[model samples]
Target: MKARILFVCLGNICRSPMAEAVMRHQVEQAGLNDRIEIDSAGTGDWHLGHPPHEGTRKLLDEHQISYQGMKARLVAESDFETFDYIVCMDTKNLRDVRELLKNAGTLESRAKVFTFMELLPDKGIADVPDPYYDGNFPFVYELVNSGCRELLKRVQADLKLA
Candidate 1:
């Protein structure tokens, strides 16, 4: 089975989608596109069906990463069963995801949920700040890029991929 991964954030138009694109790029580069699946969603439905924020699109374009066909969507109960890893952007997102899972009685899901920063504990950062509010798309891209690189390493090890 393919190793399925999901990136989550509050709006899905900024951080999570950015992570999604970056992770997808790395996965393709590693030739693991056929072995793994990647997607992203938001904890809220405010931006449902909307494309990623302009900052996210601009930065991704600058990096030559493709965020094509990625529309904002809310996290669904089915995601717990579909994804092997659900990575959140911050503590609040993590909490919301866990609460949703608990409320839906799917807390026993096989998926391992965690914050993106958990993959790099040495970074000393707990959250990937929202570029939508701060307009610091460049900094956010750097964080997402670094986190996605580390995440790919973890996924490869977990899946025993070379």
Candidate 2:
């Protein structure tokens, strides 16, 4: 089975979608597109059906990373069963996702939910800041890129794709 990954944040328009695009790019580059699946969602429903934030779009365009056909979506309880990894952009997102799973009575899911920063503990950063407000897409892109690279390695090892 493909190793499914879900990137999450407060609003799908920013960090999560950026991470999704970056991870997708890396996966395709590694030739693991066939072995892995990637997607993104938000803990909040505010941006449902909306495309990524303008900053995200512009930065992605600058990097030549395609965010094609990507839309903001809310995290669903079923995601617990569907994705092998549910990566959050920050601590609050992580808490919200776990709380959602708990409230849904999905105490035990195959998905391992965690903050994106957990993949790069030495970075001394706990959150992938929201560029929607600060307009720091470039910095967020750097964090997302680094995290996605590490995440790909973890997924490869976990799924035995490496």
- How many Å off is the CA of 25 in candidate 2? 0.5
lDDT tens digits, residues 1-162, model 1? 589999999989999999999999999999889998999999998999999999999999998999999999999999999999999999999999999999998568778999998987888999988888889999989888988889888888888875
Q: How many clashes in each candidate?
A: 0, 0
Q: What lDDT would each prediction earn against the true structure?
A: 0.93, 0.93
Stretches > 4 Å off in candidate 1: none
Candidate 1's displacement at residue 107, Å, is 2.4
Best by lDDT, which number? 2
* Residue-wise C-alpha lDDT for candidate 2, range 11-100, written one tens digit per residue: 899999999999999999999989999999999989999999999999999999999999999999889999999999999999899899
Estimate the overall C-alpha local distance difference test score of candidate 1. Answer: 0.93
